[model samples]
Target: MKTTSTDESSAGGVTPVAPDAATLESEKESMLRQPVAVWATALACVFAFMGIGLVDPILPAIAENLDAGPSQVSLLFTSYFAVTAVMMLVTGAVSSRVGGKRTLLTGLTLIVIFAALAGTSGSVGELVAFRAGWGLGNALFVATALAVIVAVASGGRAVAIILYEAALGLGMACGPLVGAVLGDLNWRGPFFGTAVLMLIALLVLVVKLPSTPVTGERTSFAAPLRALRHGGLFGVSFSALFYNFGFFTVLAYTPFLLDSGEYGIGLVFFGWGSALAVFSVFIAPVFQNRVGAANTTMLTLCGLVAVYVLLGVFHGTPWVVTVLVVVSGALLGVNNTMYTEMAMSVSDNPQPVASAAYNFVRWMGGVIAPFASTELAEKFDPSVPYFTAAAAAVVAVTVMLFTRSAVEVHGPHAV
Candidate 1:
């Protein structure tokens, strides 16, 4: 009897190992079941985004306690967003040289340092300056976070983008609730809490995230600016600039309108953030698949315009204002998801370069609108800020309509 050491077929040929059914099932797992690195990065993303709305619940508290005016307290957002906007121009340059993972860590470290410092601020000016530092950290992380997620996530780009937006929504939703809880104890608590949460995220990322290899390619500081030559990218970025004016008006100015105290304002915006999260994750894809990305963006921008108009009309009625704020979150979600997809896909420029370019432009709205809205409200009335935002929204819609052809993707182009 001749016994073969190797497992051979009856014909004396080696039998290949067949993958098990379980192995195939694992291979086909859904987007929810991602790798450790993806989850770690996404978790960090949630914490990072929380910083956006963290101050909303405490805006009134800060203004009252610090003995500062609405416009002065509003500078918190002004300084933060202004720094964030400027930093976007160089994120690609930094990340390309040091690599994505290190860049993320560096950003996280800055946030930890700045958030703690912000907690100890004795005046609005000090707080605003520290918040600017936080924005610097946020820009580095925010610019790199999407790229890391896209690079590591399974399924596809659509799934990855959705995940990133979901993180944004969750962070936004939770930010106010957390701020209310902590800020009620002391206005400084939220800042310290943010520092702790970010520190945890930083440590988790260091362990779970694998190193990203340096490609030895350095993006110039002007690379993001040069990316704007693409008609599609430029169209998306320009329209987003005006669109954000309306969006930030809603976010930064509405707290004073609510005047509901810390907990009440927190709950209201929590509901708003929840709406944003739900629509961006569940509803945005449905609309995009039905109407196409550019069309969806325009439709949502129109919806935002109507919302702003209603806000202007009902500024005196707190109930109506609250309801409008929640509803606007839904429209904002759709627009945000569509705008991001278009910016990433619209041009052949590298994803980092495109994001840096797109953000550099769009964030200008965030920089201007917060203080601008407060100043408008001070000079005229609360309704005037909403009206100003409505006009900006109208301009946004017109710009998109004119540039629709440049940004149209696989969807129908009726807009």
Candidate 2:
């Protein structure tokens, strides 16, 4: 006798057919078993994002080697992210005109050139300027990467986004390790290493990814800004700005608070990054499946606020602060995945346009936090930045609450 999977004898009639073990396993495995193109783009993405934290362990070395003040050296981040934020507006336009494959190659080429130039710099100003160029390259590549991944990857948007976030987390976790190891030998080594790795990613992409020149209507320069008019997209991006403030506070300011050597600080952030990867890939989805995306976002934001508060309360305690920093990564990973998914689904704009718009607003917090946290620490005290970050997180939570309906998810696994 053949048996069906569902029961139909209930008062309400037919019961919903739940997926069986085989079906469930297939879905789970799909996320892992992507095509060569998806893996290539993801691998390149890892190298691209590594540039963000690549200098974290070597900031002091750069300052000392170049005879520059902390403020000037900090401009490394300021310049990189500032250019990245502003150049986001141009990414969609460029990608639309040149197509995704060409655009990605161009961006990777620029990073290769600038990163190499940065390694050869004789002055802090030169390094900063080269970093700015690198940012321009990053802007093009990073903005287009998510759209490309979503378009090509199997399973669904949910699985694709998880892959992207995993790449982000892995890159972030590994960036500091690379920086610490190479920087311990010489500050220029990290820059050169990033350049070489990016070069390899570029070559692999050229071979593995097919040409995808756009045939659709070209995106305008103002498309990203215009895309922000959608309430859901705008609200999500706005909240992200505040949320990122808290995120960067820990990333930029915590090292100073640790007062550890390069290797020690590198290991701490590595742990943080590893936790971020694991949580984003494995745990965040479970939370989303259990509570839905909207609720999960709110819960994680609250968790972050609490973490920031604890960091402030224990600023003088290195081990506690170190642990909290790693803990924050889990929360950050969840939020990053959720926000990117929402940003893509929230608007009717093209994926690249939506990504460009969201990143534009999102990275402003990156630009502000490093300088703001450091300045606050100098002007007030060590604890003030964490308290301030907590306040910023509160603002994020409040914004999310108010904007909740626009981006709310109904089912377990809904993107």
Candidate 3:
């Protein structure tokens, strides 16, 4: 028997967690079984992501209901991503400390409560303020949920990523339907429904999830930033930011551009979300196991650039646009999964700072994407945003070309 050394004095004398055979075996099985915790965490991720899309089609209606302008309505999106941007580092660190399950529960609770408040707000200021608070909850949940899957899942990092991201795709696939159906009743209905989903997931998580050993201790203030400077972390982080920026810019308005009423919602999400779903399950593994992360990213980047450009030039045909979007979506999922696995694998140290930096970089794109799209629509052709995404994807591929030397096995026992 490998007797693990126990250090009870660490972590504020919170009983030091021993990664024993029994615990490891249990974790190993739980992961394989797709136990409640795995599903719970995935469900939570689905809900969080759905929040991003749910408000999109309804923003105009919401603005009218609240007597707000387009600019003011935009805050609903901005405030959400903004808080998520600022708080991700802290959220990752705190989850590592207290435990992933605990932090997620609290965060989801806040989102439910605050989201309801924002949904009912009578004034633009109130709605924006509460939405920012809602964003705080989203930040905590989204950042840590992935980390939790990575931490506790015993089916290897690839499996963890696949399962978690699969749920995310399912959540996203369902969001527009939920919004379309619920929005017809009232603007607040989706928010309230989301709250119910979160509550149910919280219960499932508490019952099934094991406690995660603290993954990192707070360092002297400067060490985190310094750790992030190593192993091309900065490049990866920025790419994460730009990745989202590029994707969302295209996604936010693609329906307006290509949605000719013939395909309706099913084909739209089926093309976009279903591609992600299929890849997360069937295709993501090819990148990690066979193609290799950086090489896969390069391939995906080329596909994204090509598809966007194709959409720009040939979107008059609905089939052409659908195929292009589906290809883009499939490639996007691969790019994200492989890039994330690569980034985490790059550093030997615990990943809190690295994770934060990565998320911060990605959210920068989310922040910029909408503005870029809106501005391009104002000044250039609407197709400009699609072309801009194509250009950004090209830039990412170029960056990867330079940074390939930095890729290596990130964990000692990595598969």
Candidate 4:
């Protein structure tokens, strides 16, 4: 009887030996371990993401305090995402020229200044304008943070991605809770609180994070826009755009449908954010692995559509709406991960350019949804906006179906 060695066990092929348990354990450890700079940056990312939902618990309060209608208040999201979307194109260009560290500092400083200003605003218009400025800073910081983490982290790109996603999840989950606690005191409390926390993150980054020099060729301002010429990239971007329409509608408008106090809204969204975090960090990969990215995206979009429809049907029922809102987070979480993976893999353009292009297009949905949903509700009925959101989800599902082949061809092995 012939026996094979542990290193060479293949019968007629050259299949590589699988990593042993000790090697795998070492790799796991490496992935988990991070440098101080990376931790600081990640901490800043947490605060950055907190800004997304921090205003949620205070939306009603803001409206009541400033005598703004729902449509006017919703412009906060419109202006912020609009500026962020446009700035996405410039982030790569600026980072390439100024280096990542300066870009990050610049972004963080802008956020600190603007968030504090937003807290002091006497009118909704002022807050909206400040939020737009905050968006610019956020765009600059987020666009570069991932690349820096990937470059400096102990593990490879995969581990870096996991870390970034974890930060996003944690930040998103905690943002509402923080907002609720502070907004209970005053409508302006969440804004000032965000400013203080972001300042802390900024100081930590300044002290711990080393300056990252420009490493390669500078990217052009137009590079991201030009990347949309690729069929696969364009398809994914547009599909994500529609998906985000549904996403922000639920996020930005649902609070108006409920009579809940600031604390109640915060508690409900805390559950929503928690569900989002859990699914994004843990469940997304497993679902993607089992269903493939295209199918997974389609499934999640379908789920979103159903949730939106249910939300519309039961808008008057606070308990029902709250439950559906929390459930929708799971679907949104899966879709977010799948769409991000698709955007990253389905294009031949450099990762940064492609990411910028995708973000620019997709965020349009966020820019439009808040104002549009509020207008639709005011013009027709409250349920109309949810139905519109459901329609957008349908469009997203259709687009994903049509673009499956192109995406599959260019997608990563796992996808």
- Please give, for residues 54-85, the per-residue lDDT of candidate 1 as tens digits: 89999999999999999999899889989999
What lDDT score is found at residue 215 in candidate 1?
91
Which is better, 1 or 3, measured by lDDT? 1
Q: How well does candidate 3 score on lDDT at residue 251?
A: 59
Please provide, for model 2 over 1-415, each residue's C-alpha lDDT reduced to its tens digit, 9 standing for 90 to 100: 0011224322222222334566556667998899999999999999998888788888777878899865677778878899999999999999989999998999999999999999999999899899999999999899988888988998756678889999999999999999899989999999999999999999999999988968779999999999999888898899999999998888877877787878988899999888989988888867765665667888999999999999999999999998999999989988888877778766667779999999999999989888888888888888999999999988988888877877653122332
Write candidate 3's Cα lDDT for 1-415 as tens digits.
0111235222212211324457545544645676566777887788877777666546656757888655456666667788888787587567756777778888888888887787677888887798889888888787778877766665545567667777777776677667656766787777777777777777777778787766556433343466667756666666666567667865565655554432253356555776777776567654554555667777877888888888778756777776777777787777766767666656644555566667766776776676567567657786787888888888888877776666633321221
Task: Report the C-alpha displacement of residue 411, candidate 4, in angstroms.
Answer: 1.7
Best TM-score goes to which candidate? 2
Q: Which residue pairs in candidate 4 collide?
A: none
Quantify all predictions' global Cα lDDT against the true fold. 0.86, 0.85, 0.67, 0.84
Clashes of 4: 0
Candidate 3 lDDT (Cα, 0 to 1): 0.67
lDDT of 1: 0.86
Clashing pairs in 1: none
Model 3 clash pairs are 240-362, 241-361, 241-362, 245-365, 345-410
Ranked candidates (TM-score, high to low) = 2, 4, 1, 3
TM-score of each: 0.92, 0.93, 0.83, 0.92
Ranking by lDDT: 1, 2, 4, 3
